[model samples]
Target: AASLLGAPIGHDLCIISLSDLMTPWERIEKRIRAAAIGDFVTAVYNPKSEGRYWQLYRLKELFLEERSPGTPVGYVRQAGREEQVVNLTTLAEFDPEQVDMFTVILIGNSQSYEAGGKFITPRGYYGEIKMKTDVGIGQDIMIRSFRTIEKELKDKEMPLDKKWALLHAIHTTADFDMENILRIDDHAVASLYEKFNRGEVRTIITDVTMAASGIRKGALQRMGIEVKCYLQDERTIQLATEKGITRTQAGIRLAVQEHPGALYAFGNAPTALIELCDLIRKGKATPAGIIAAPVGFVHVQESKHMVKPFVSIPKLIIEGRKGGSNLAATLVNAILCYNDAEQLKPGRDV
Candidate 1:
């Protein structure tokens, strides 16, 4: 396919004809490579016919080498005619087999994005969309901060759930190092949201009261999820005194005995996480999920390593000794608001 740049309406768009009927295939390929290297939004005409089936596939492979899989691609068939058909898909999902001689394909440039079911190429101007008046200044500032973090993200091609949680983690700590430390299981956020929405998992057990209190009460109330900490429980104190174990470790035992299926979160006590791991191994507790981010220099690294073998459980872990109560709570917030992931919207209950 010959790629062409057709910039109309003062925007740069390259139009290339892939028809080899009147042009040499090698010359057409050279032009396509140049357009790809130039990062031009491209349009292809006569992409495929019965004799030209493999050409479109090669064109797609060439573009992929220079483009993000998230790049938008749209196609129209029999344009300006009653039989016209339009389709929008990503470059990763673009199907060459669906094209014919009558179809015209348009691929988005680096700055182009898909919005509202249409491919949008910016005309070099942007305006800030104001939030509602009732959202308050703090929420507005937080939203702005999220946008800034998003723009500076090193890898913006991650899954929506991971990206959503990453924004919150970075916003809370203002630590760019979090981009490298945060590790989330595939579909963990979405699967937990489904469970929470169905009221399957309703309790969260934190290693300390700080983590329990850090989570927003409004969101917990709205979701009907309880944040529980057994650190101050009389039974935990007694268990620690009798067994000569750390109070936090004893607290996990009491919490697990009471709420075996609760979502277990750790932010300040590695000993507590290790104790839970012991319980899980012994079949004494089966948690809904785990957030292993207990921050410390002691057994912090080991505690995280302890939980990784249970691949069946959904988990979110901060790999190093760089986690805290705020980080743990923000991740919980990410799960509570995951329905807004597609829009990158947060603080629904704020």
Candidate 2:
């Protein structure tokens, strides 16, 4: 029903049965919240019945929490049957009085729209891009930017995941030089993604709060990955004084002591990266992977050079003085979406 109604078949979709017969209401509501927050095309089965009319209203309320009132939604009654009936409406205008258990509701994602009475969700199959004034303006702009990056990218021959990561970096900075500077070890993204999925690595230690803040919180929460920054921790302040070290260095030490196997990402602090390297050499830390991209003239180049010897650990490096919190966060985003590399469908969860 969703595909027929013009939901983007190429993008992520969430199918939900709102019947609380065997499933607890809370659990079903949890799924609804996830779908809404993730901005996925949602197809709802068993939306209403004699005893379930209120549930559908609650679901609408949940969707409205994330989506605009004008978001497109469609429904089909007895779809594909002799008495098939389909209707298109905005989310605010979708009337539950007309729906029942036999009806299937299709609520478009943030990018969905109503055109020529057909419900539509656009998920970036970009030969040309058009901006629509709708609930998904931000995503539309991002999709346009991604297509622009694709057209302007210098190296189209790189591996899919690496190229995907580069796209993210270029998107973040608008710096085409990322093609020349960004480096990914063989299968680095895949390895880290596996560890994340297997629950072997659940934490990411960033050198600063800015780096931590830039990471996509929606994906991190869904994957149950914890991002921790110790720079602002009082314990880190105390430790810095005790060790006579820079706050960033102390933060890394404290982070390593707590999560020795977590992925460590460096953005603003070269000293922190240097300190992590020192810890790894001295058997104090065993990070799952390292993102070595600290932007500075002071020890930044040296810090990246220091991390190169640890061939056993996976890595993504941005060479030279071009790195930031956004860059590190976007690289993390790339690995998390590595499974989507071949498909070129980034940002399933915004």
Candidate 3:
């Protein structure tokens, strides 16, 4: 079965039912020792339950005699279901109580490590090449960013129109460094807008400070939206313009140096954003896809784990590790399913 499924030779299968309800402990122990001597990759079934728990520990000891502690161990709890939790840990950390009748454990032949806190079991590419797996990392970062925004926006749900207009005005004003509003609130609004426009947000809100400059009024006017502001301050407007240039210049630098995959910018940071945009438009970067967070950016191309071919606007404005992880997992699942279905279909030959 392993060979037919493209698994390598010398791959022997060992199954041990950890449940003591039917199978005696003596029989289970004997099978464990035999499989260890046989050097077979073992799959455990019925590893834990309310009544039985020590089997998992005993099996670990049995395998430890023959196998190195660094062996790759995979845990699939409730596999192929909505409540599925799959992870690869080391044999040393393997716990029997973590699994029940619904769990399946696969332990490999001594090659696993914790990289950046993730358990990685390499197949053939251990020393071959550096993996283009930064997408996964970037996705992780994006998820963190999204959670921040989601928490901030949790309470304000209805009347999205007010949220939308205010958010837009706030973002525009903030970019211009407009004053009269608290700096912290401006930062929040700035961050919120940046996050929202990245294609993730459906709505947002802003605070209005009248007698502040007509910046919001002017912006609303240009956008054909009506809004009234009290207490317009010319002094604040003057200072905002001076500070805005400095902010824009800083953004341009960070976007260029910090973001590896950013090919373009679409907002007020014109000199920098426009340059990047032009490069992207001209096909120089040939970006696999675009990911926008509140202030984070990354580019990705399709690879084994990520099977989606590069497309325009793969995901917009959604940020953080959770979003990226979900996207990557979805893409991989879709590709694998499609490939399997294609193989099973009738041949084209007449």
Off by over 4 Å in 2: 1-135
Residues 78-148, candidate 2, lDDT per residue (tens digit)?
A: 98899988888878788888888899998876556566678866655444555433436566567556655
Candidate 3 lDDT over 105-137, as tens digits, reads: 765543333444344333343235433332344
The TM-score of predicted model 1 comes to 0.71
How many pairs of residues collide in each model? 11, 0, 20
For residues 1-350, write the lDDT of model 1, one tens digit per residue. 11221222335667788876788889989988888878788889888877778888899988887775667788888877788888888887999988889988998766555556767654442244444334565665665577567656788578988888898999999998888999999999888888998999999999999999889888899899999998899998999999999999999999888899989989999999999999999999998899999998999999999999989899999998989898888899888889876644467666
lDDT to native, each model = 0.82, 0.84, 0.39
Which candidate tops TM-score? 1
Judged by lDDT relative to the true structure, which candidate is superior, 1 or 2? 2
Pairs that collide, model 2: none
List TM-score per model, in order: 0.71, 0.63, 0.31
